[model samples]
Target: MNNNAYNINIFSGGAELLFDNKRHYNIDLPNKDTWKLGDLLIWLRDNLLSERPELFIQNNSVRPGILVLVNDSDWELMVSSDLWYLICSLCQILCKYAPCP
Candidate 1:
C-alpha cells in the first residue's frame, strides 16, 4: 500500500492548525483504486452541506466551511470529488505514519 502519488498542502502547521499560511505534510499512502466519484458528493453532503433548520438558508451550504480548494474547483462540484478526497484522505490516514524527529 504505497501511496506516493499524492500529497496535501496545508494552510498551516503546528498545534494551532491556523489557516493563514502555507504548510505541507507528506506520507506514503495506499492507492485509491477502490474509491469512486459518488463518495465525494456524499461526503460533502454529509459533512458540509446538509443543514439544520436552526441555521440560515445560505449558511446551510458547505460553501463557507471549505478550507481549501484543489485545482480551483471545490470537490462538491467536480466530476470526481472522490479523487480529491482520496488524496486528502491519504493525508489524514497516513499522518500517524510520520517518522519521529
Candidate 2:
C-alpha cells in the first residue's frame, strides 16, 4: 500500500469514498483490509457519521462498508471482532513510512 497517500475509504450512513492523499472521490473498494469488519463499522459510525461527515463522499456510490469475518467468528459477540487488532497493526506499519505532514 502507498503509505504516503491517505488512500483510505471513508464510509458512513449511505456514503462511500476514497481519500487519495488530499483528493477525495467516490470509488469501489474491491480489496480487503486488516480491520475487523465490526470494529471498522463502529469506527465509521462514530468517526464519520457522527463526527466528521465532511470526510465522507457524497455521491451515488455503493456504501463504503467493511465486510469481513474475523477468525470464523460472527461479529455479534461484541468483543470477539479483530478489527482493532488489524487497525493497530496497520497503524504501526504505516507509521514507519508515514508521509511528512
Candidate 3:
C-alpha cells in the first residue's frame, strides 16, 4: 500500500448523513510530486466520499459552505491557478459549517 499519508477531519454541519455518519479519514495520497489541492479533491471524490458528492463539491470546486485548511492556515491564502501543489507537506482539513445539507 502507498504510504504517503494525509490527515483529514470532517464535521457534519448536517452533511455527515451522506458520509455514513463517519467524520475522519487518513488517506495515502498518490505517489506523485505534483499532487495539488485539485488532485486531492478528485482523490477524495473517488476514495472517501460516500454519496451526494454535490454537497461537498460543485462546479469542480468545493461547495460554498465548505472550508479547507492546511497546516492551520486557510487554503485560500496559498491558492494559485485553482490549485496548490505538494499538499503532502502538512496536515489538511476539510470542514463544513451550518445547515449545509
Candidate 4:
C-alpha cells in the first residue's frame, strides 16, 4: 500500500438499495493528510453512489434524515470549525438513511 493510501470500510444501512443493494465496501483512499470527511463524501458521491445522489448529498454535506457515523461516532460531533473533520486510517464510515414516512 502507498504511504499516502489507507483502507476504510463503508456500510450503507437503509441506503444500500440506492447503491445497487450493496451494503458494504472496502475502500482504499489515496491521500491521507489531505483527506477530510467532506472530501470523502464527495468522493463517495462521485465514485460509489449508483443513484439518487441528491438524496445523499446536499450543500456539500449529507441531507436530512441521513446519519453519518465515523469510527462509531456521530459525524456531527466530530465536525470542526470548518465542518470538515480529518479522516484517519482504518476508520469505519456508516451511512444510514431513515425510511421515508
| Of 1 and 3, the candidate ranking higher by lDDT | 3
TM-score per prediction, in order, is 0.33, 0.24, 0.75, 0.84
Worst 10 residues of 1 by lDDT: 91-100
Candidate 3's C-alpha lDDT?
Answer: 0.69
Q: Candidate 3 lDDT, tens digit per residue, 16-84?
A: 565677887777776786777877877777777788887777888878777666666677787764565
Top candidate, metric TM-score? 4
Worst 10 residues of 4 by lDDT: 1-10
lDDT of 4 at 99: 62
Candidates' lDDT values, in order? 0.34, 0.31, 0.69, 0.77
Return whichever of 1 and 3 wins on TM-score. 3
Question: What lDDT does candidate 1 reach at residue 63?
Answer: 27
- Model 4 clashing-pair count: 0
Superposing every Cα of model 4 onto the true structure, what RMSD results? 2.1
* Per-residue error (Å), model 2, residue 68: 9.9
TM-score rank order: 4, 3, 1, 2
Alpha-carbon shift of residue 72 in model 3 (angstroms): 2.3
Residue 17 in candidate 3, Cα distance off native in Å = 3.5
Model 4: residues with Cα > 4 Å off, grouped in runs: 3-10, 80-82
Model 2: per-residue lDDT, tens digit, 1-101? 53222223322222332222322222222345545433444443344343344333223211234222233332334345432444322221110111223
**lDDT, residue 75, model 4:** 89
